[model samples]
Target: MPRHGRLHIPGGCYHVMGRGLERRRIFYADADKQDFLDRLGETLARNGSQCVAWSVMTNHYHLLIRVGDQPLAKLMAPLLGGYAGHYNRRHHRSGYVFQNRYKSILCDADAYLLELVRYIHLNPLRAAMVKNLTDLDRYPWTGHSALMGHRKQDWQSVSEVLGLFARGLGTARRRYREFVVQGLEERDSDELLGGGLVRSYGGWEGLKRLRKEHVYCIGDERILGDSDFVERALAQDTLKVEQATQRIQAGWDLDRLIRRVSQYCGIKEEQLTQKARGNDLSLAKALICLWGSQELKLSLREIAHRLSISQPAASQWVNRGRKFCRELGIEFEVIDS
Candidate 1:
């Protein structure tokens, strides 16, 4: 299988979303909704994550989560998949529950913070679940009420959004209430779902400025994370690959490899040349040395000189390792060397 790269984002702020398979109802009843919240609470406790915003729609959901030490996949894998299993078993259904893999976008918190909050809060309003902002305020299923102080949720991180709008809770709630209510009557300047980098910029000019400066983060649209964050994520990934290559390099020297194999595989170095290769440990040592040679780009002569064996013998060992590695999908040429 080909290597799958990690989705590199700029910063911690992310807008993650997913839908029910076939756009079916994700919440069939109040029990399903409450169970979802319970699972979310458990996930937050388990992963040590902060939930900035979220809303559970009938067929889809939205989230603005600050990723913790674990990758978002680690947390969601159990959360969503486990939930889907429960949902399916309960309803006598099978196969996928969510529409697809959750959509996650990295965001620039300073730039798109308020915009995201309003967008996330006003989902019910957009869907016409509420008649207007007045009804939205009284709606029980959305995060808008939580932000406005009309309702409360233990799992929601209200301070992040509240702090963005004002210094005090009372003032913040007042502003957020107004924002959500006002948004019901107005269309946002930018598309909340598309425009990727353009959304982060706030307008075409913002996107133009970033493009002019030549910034590209391995991030998706609908995400509002930071550029410096994107750079770091990509850089860390490069470092991991580089480190793996270094492991291969260190194991490339045939003489040293033979020594390591002799020590690790428990075959005396004297036996390496005698074709007395019945030892399992001895074979593994040879395999390691050969794999390292191919992965590290070591010359045949160099490998032969180090092993104190003919170039033909060294090449044979390397070939054996290459075939085995291809079959086993073992890329780390040196695990302990």
Candidate 2:
């Protein structure tokens, strides 16, 4: 089936999840878990993104993050690709690393923040990892511990979730624990997880009303929480990519692109950071690097020196420039054209 769509927005908050194909175990040992977390940390840092909550299970993982200005495609490209490659190499395995494209739900922070926080924090308990309330309080994989002010990691921005609860961290933890305890005892109910209108409402009647009103953003019935959140998040993500791509094609580089890259694109010096790759981006980068070596009167050795790429690789990039131009269906103009 063609995909339904995606939800996305600048500064959108999302609850993201990925499961293994056929429900297979993706992490079999401690090293696998640690490596995955390491990748998570690096990706968030490198991408200039923030992670609110996350947990790694044997076959699935959960994350709550706020999307920055960069489209999910570009932002996730390096993070997911890099981690998949590393994991495959280390495990001596090949083929797909994650199931499908993964799920990202765009949540209205004001309405759903506390509920979603509870939902994510209690994931381990829902899986029976902790067995009891006492055990869940300290479950290491979740941001719940950090929210309680018991375990703090700078990477997990607790303020957003923490702010929703009054009575401070200690009081919040006690109340939150009770909430999760009740939630675990009640996960069987469709109403609690599948909210209506907002992440807070419940009941079939409420959902029926939402549907009647032509509401979107409902979540998958098979999964818990609001489906509308997922729907809207995916849509916004697609839109963002389109807009960023248009800006790049229009020759307006907002990120002050590298001079060498500008010379290569023949548009301006800012297209490199315009966040629209599609086909043009890769070609532009390759062409720019190539022009630095070929037509600019810059020697391969000098080009390699300037770009910090090896002379052979630099020459190959230049050689690939024309081919890339043809492949992208872009006209080739000399450097500084």
**lDDT (CA) for every model shown?**
0.64, 0.58
What TM-score fits each model? 0.59, 0.55
What does candidate 2's lDDT look like per residue over 231-270, in tens digits?
A: 3333444553333344346563322224545555554544
- What TM-score should be assigned to candidate 1? 0.59
Per-residue error (Å), model 2, residue 190? 4.8
lDDT for model 1, on a 0 to 1 scale? 0.64
lDDT for residue 83 in candidate 2, whole number 0-100: 70
Model 1: per-residue lDDT, tens digit, 1-337?
2324334432366778889889989899978887887888889879878788887889998888777776677667888977898998889988888875677766544335566777887888788877887777767777777877778888888876776455678987787777666666788655455434433343334665777799642333443333333333344434535333565555545555566656655667766556535755446645654644433435555655655654435545655655665776655434453
| Residue 276, model 2, lDDT | 37
Clashes of 1: 13
